[model samples]
Target: MPTPELIPADQQLSWRAITDADLDGWEALLRRMAVEDKPDWIEQRADLEEVLAAKKNNPVLDTILGVDGEGTPRSFGRISANAGSNMVHVFGGVDPAWRRRGIGTAIHEWQVARARKRQADAGIPDGFIRAYVEESNPGHRALLESSGATVVRWFTEMTRDLAEDIPEVDLDPEFEIVAFSDDISESMRLAHNEAFQDHWGSEPRDEESWRFTVTHPEFRPDWSLAVIDKSSGEVAAYEISSYDPESKELVGFIEGYTELLGVRRAWRGRRLAPALLAEAMRRFKADGMEHAGLGVDTENPSGALGLYERMGYTPTRRSMAFEKVLS
Candidate 1:
């Protein structure tokens, strides 16, 4: 556990482990930060509550919240590491009104310390810690750099206006696109693990995490689809989407966000990806969405960026992934 002294005394804030009681304040702070840092992605109270209730997360040990004298959350940090994985994923943010006060630095320091402790306890000798920041956020980039974390990768968020024509890509007769459902969820997870095996920073998501995603409040099963191999009866590809009401309210446009898109190695050349995307876009349009949004790794080995570009998506935002190797 990080000592109380780790919190910057100059900031006049109280730092401690987060609990259910902090949900309202934490979510409010996150919403405010998202509006300032990344308007398209906002974490709501339900999302934070789900994170706190996750079996894999130990908030008392791996999470920290810094609050002002008035008990308003100003900054917070949380870290997660799987039992056998060498990666520690860190997430948190500081209130926009409190920037440049060393509050972000303090939160980051606490996150790194907790990450190291987690790796040490797990006996991971060659692990690494990762955090992401928007390209427009120089303060966050500098903070990571000062901690010796290098920018390992870049990602771009793309949007397609539903008002434009969506191309029709025929799915090969050997495969069929099926609606996403609970019965095929586990199979799709296996297919996803296989599809992204060669992708950067890709790791097999455990059932708990996958379930959390499919059961999220914003998850739109009606908009999600899967490609099934006719002969093998296997899930060959998938496109999962969600509708963020807060984002629509903030951006003033109804957008269907594609959260995950993948095509297995064997099914790559069959145009399944484009077909799934096209079908998803049609559904989004039918449902009165004004735009389609998705994020992709700039260097995706599967040529995803090219695919999205050909599908009429334009880059709107960029983010950097930073990593620090643990000895």
Candidate 2:
């Protein structure tokens, strides 16, 4: 590929993986361009660190930067290894002031090339990559689609308001809501594997991955809740949410996510999911959050959409996933 011209900025723009030293600039750029529903730039420091750590250690993950003519980074993107499968997650951001200048398209083109190069280094297939873009984020969706990626899944970031009375959900009397903990974490992990066991392209996760995801910077153990059978203490349902100040998540957008709401197989259709979600919303409301959010697979076997809808979660954004095979 010919060298990308330096951005119009006085200094020449260069592109490269974000290092710890680049956190300041990267976060600043993210804050300036990110739209609602995306993580705030300032708060992304830790998250980006996590992404970098994964890329640095996993060998399969990669990040690219686009600098201006003056050696200033104007945009960036990353690809995370999907150890559960051969696919990778492609993500990125561009300064709002710099849009329509081909910065986004440039970064995406670089991302695909980076993914291919990583595949060569790791000796893994140059598998197609996937990305999630909010249905409302037309600019980003256009960039990815124009890059030859295809939408494969439509996901929803749902919201449930806690100020409203908690809906009466029918759950077994034996099950009780419990705070998150190591014990509950294991059960939550197991439930995720089971609930998504047959979901398209689902992959098994180890304790290591679970540890990384669950303990993310946004994790607030106290906000997480698990439902268990009183006698056996077997986890039946659970809610995972993370904290984000209005600064991180623009106002009106859910500052906290109702991250994961999982129910055991035998407990399906028993109203466990809603009841658990209601309880979580109640908790989030008490914690002073105006709203809580969660994502749902449109084709969930457990009818997750109906459950979330019943809980008063409207569709805020339809996140679409796209893929293109690279072999």
Candidate 3:
């Protein structure tokens, strides 16, 4: 175990989970990070209240941060285990001046130990822990590695400058493209489950999951578009989009988050995904977006990375997944 260099009694700090009252500080830290590193354009915040409301109910979420001897928050970090599993994921950022003194490693140790406690309390068996580390920020990767994490796979964050004007698609005469309204929640859930069935670490998403998803503070229905089988009126492919009018000034980033884009196996190889994505891009640009973004696995079996590249989305940040099996 790595010992955190002592911060002297006057400076020794403790860690705390974020509370509703910490929103200001939390937002400040997030915005500050944005200024320091303009990450992918897809990261947005459409409805923060809804997100915080949902987060309040999450049993597997803990935003851990260190506080100074004076009780001021000096860092921000989070540990989240996917529901119904022992696979905890953690990420953190310490204040600039306080870094390089082992505080990050200490927080990482604290996060892992917390995950272990959560598993024990829930009677879950020991399993693997997973996390994503961005190549743009080597310091974070180093911190996680110092805590025994090993990079297992790399993923790419792709961005499409909607300003580039991807061509429009002439939807197949037999297909219908439409906004996924609230009433079609079930269809969205069904489509998402099927679309992601073959994806890495994917699991079936039911109604409960959909309920939580669309209502996330960041979910914007107007920005979301879907395609359906005109004959059966069943959802065929979908692409979700969002723009945080608040982040990065009033003119914000629009993200084409392909939450679940797929044509059922029966309808595969019809070029539905690219078609839907193109439509989504056009719609977002029309709504005053300056840029669009999406994340794709470089080695996805579906060749999604190639498709995004074809759409003019270049990789801006290289992120790797780290996993460790618990003994």
Candidate 2 local lDDT, 60-146, one digit each (tens): 236667667766667787777665356777888777767777767766776777677666677786477888777767888888878
The order of the candidates by lDDT, greatest first, is 1, 2, 3
Give the local distance difference test score of model 3.
0.67
Off by over 4 Å in 1: none
**Candidate 3 TM-score versus the reference:** 0.83
Give the clashing residue pairs of candidate 1, or none. Answer: none
Number of clashing pairs per prediction, in order = 0, 16, 1
Candidate 3 residue lDDT tens string, 213-322: 77766666876777888899888877766555453452245454555556666677778878878887777778776676777777788888888788787876688898
**TM-score to native of every candidate shown:** 0.96, 0.85, 0.83
Sliding window of 10 residues with minimal summed lDDT for model 2: 1-10
Alpha-carbon local distance difference test for all models: 0.88, 0.70, 0.67
Q: Which order, best to worst by TM-score?
A: 1, 2, 3
